[model samples]
Target: MEKQTPPEQDTIFDEAELLGDGYDKHVRRARNTIFVVASVQFVFGLVLGFSGPEESKWISIGIMSIVAGIFAGLGFWASKKPYQAILIALILFCGLILLDVIFDPASIFKGIILKIFIIVYLIMGVNNARQTLRIKQALGKE
Candidate 1:
């Protein structure tokens, strides 16, 4: 009779399985955070658009409100597929920052600071989603 050797345990797989639940929770929290922030931005944009004087600035505010609505919609979709949402959000944020810089150079410093904070927050959410997905893939390989 021939003797068979058992396959060696993979440390990576073991680690992933151990952390699988935690990763799921992390992803959930990140998704929720994104949703909340997006919702807030949408509401704020709406208020700004409507509460402002009926001047030319209202047109700009309306455009901003539209962008915010798109961001909120993206956030809702991101709950299912986070990575894509993160990319789109980052792109939108960058475009907004560029427009602000071009139109209101005097507030460049303030805008840059706010953008940095938002970018960091978005990156953290992206990282959580990515790590959770990676762990899922690793465990699936087992």
Candidate 2:
């Protein structure tokens, strides 16, 4: 272990090293993906607010803004807690998608391509974070 990793550096993220090497790549990707999700959600909320029924306009916008805020917060948290943040983002995104499908079966066909891409990217990010953490733990790093 000593030969595999430098001895001087210690980090607060459960001893996860943040400096050097390419270990931060997955975390960065996860964080960026989260921010992108938030941005898209917010924009969708805006678009829906104007296009949807008048009665639900404000409500829909409010709910989406809140969801977007949650993602944004997780993105910021990823800098300090990559594993937890990424995991939560993955679960939340999946859960929301599931809920949408459950509530509206036809919604699945609405944006099939975009939905697939987002799910794939989030899954990849989650997998990357998991592997990175495992490797760091093995090396006595992250």
Candidate 3:
């Protein structure tokens, strides 16, 4: 096995080198997609907050919106600080899942809207996992 480079000695590559070869453009495109997806979730949350139950649903919607906004911000931050971006994304994801469990204990498919959110969240997890792996590989940590 190759020796791990000392964190202090190793230079952090810019986002371009993080993607390697021709993948930087693809990474940017992925970030754009993440932004779009998060924006959609944010809009959905607003709609739910305005239209659903005042006590429970609105609270859930507000949390969802906050999570979505965080996700979008992470995408933007990834351009400048990819490692921290990925870390924040992972934490946000865990928080989102926990929120979902707290808000919808009766399974995400109880409502079509909730189901859609669940699917979107699952996709977000998968996408984030791929991005994390890419970042790790680029850093020679994988």
Candidate 4:
């Protein structure tokens, strides 16, 4: 009688299948993109804050700059904790959108198209960050 070879067991979480080197590259690109975007936001806020015509406007711009700086910092911190950073970014984005709607309801209709584009962009960024976190976890690097 010929000896029979045993079949290999199939594992649910195969490291090779679950984690690809491409994910690492993707995560790096996403992190850099987010950081650049946040930095630009902070810089623009700073310019607006400083170049305002009136003291009241300056104060508002200053507050906006501070918030933008915070988001930029969060983007940098995403390298270490992507999920937390993405959550904070999303929360900040939502808050800003709410404030915009509350303060300028009339302008909202005029800029509805622009606002929609921004909303979509923010959603994609959040998704990218979330995917980075998942990839890290799956790769056992988290």
Candidate 5:
């Protein structure tokens, strides 16, 4: 009798748990995105910090830097912990915008810088929101 060929080897992709770690890929992706984005922003902030603020814009830069520092800190935390990272990022984004409004400055240049932060903040917001939704969904909470 001809011996039957051994059964075809199962590939790793054929496994039931290819998803890996049961962790939400979307959340992981979003966290990684923020980590990269925030790291870039942190570097950018340093560059901007060196440029002398406009005569009347020192206060504005100080305020914006404070806000940015907070965001960077939160982004750092999120980079380390995806679950809480999204929430903190969201809070940091909103807080930056609020600070921008609360401390309006006269210099257009400073305002534009604040606006850049707003834009970056928005990007972070979107990523964080997505991560938050993914985490919640994965947990079957909502």
Candidate 6:
């Protein structure tokens, strides 16, 4: 007599749910996208801190360092809580850009292309994160 394989055996994981091939690709991209956000924050902090004017050097460094730390924290959080972390990152990024434009309107045009690219990536991350969550829920995964 032939025996039947268990349902879990047919899935990618032993018990936990896994994203399908296409969804998996999107989710992987989302994870990498979040890392990009964190890395940019870190590089920006270093650059601004070191090259800022002498008078406000310490202040700039302190502020940037804190901002970088927050991004890094969110990056780590993305591994477990992708949707929430990425959403917050996107909002924070846009808010910062808005603040810059408010202080100096011309700043909006500075590296506008890069800003657009980052914003697009963050949006993609948000979409992918939502799909991942939906998949997990549909599979009845915790």
lDDT of each: 0.67, 0.81, 0.63, 0.65, 0.54, 0.76
Better of 1 and 2 by lDDT: 2
Question: Which structure is stronger by TM-score: 4 or 6?
Answer: 6
Tens-place lDDT per residue, model 3, 1-142, is 9999865735557555665544444445545655765786788788877788777887868787887888888888767655566556556655665677798876444455744543454445445546756777767776
Q: Global lDDT for candidate 3?
A: 0.63
TM-score of each: 0.63, 0.76, 0.51, 0.61, 0.42, 0.79
* Candidate numbers sorted by TM-score from highest down: 6, 2, 1, 4, 3, 5
Output the lDDT of residue 80, model 4.
81
Q: Which candidate is the best by TM-score?
A: 6
Model 4 over residues 10-93: C-alpha lDDT tens digits?
A: 455565566456554544554555565566567767776677766667776777677767877876887787667756766776
Mind giving the per-residue lDDT tens digits that candidate 2 earns over 100-122? Answer: 99999888788888777777776
| lDDT of prediction 1 | 0.67
Q: Between candidates 1 and 6, name the one with more favorable TM-score.
A: 6
Better of 3 and 5 by TM-score: 3
TM-score of 3: 0.51
Better of 2 and 6 by lDDT: 2
Cα misplacement distance, residue 63 of candidate 1 (Å): 1.9
Backbone clash total, candidate 2 = 1
Q: Best candidate per lDDT, number?
A: 2
Poorly placed runs, candidate 1 (over 4 Å): 1-33, 36-40, 43-47, 50-58, 111-113, 134-142
Residue-level lDDT for 54 in candidate 4: 69
Residue 96: error of model 5 in Å?
1.1
Q: What is the lDDT of residue 29 in candidate 6?
A: 66
2 or 3, greater by lDDT: 2
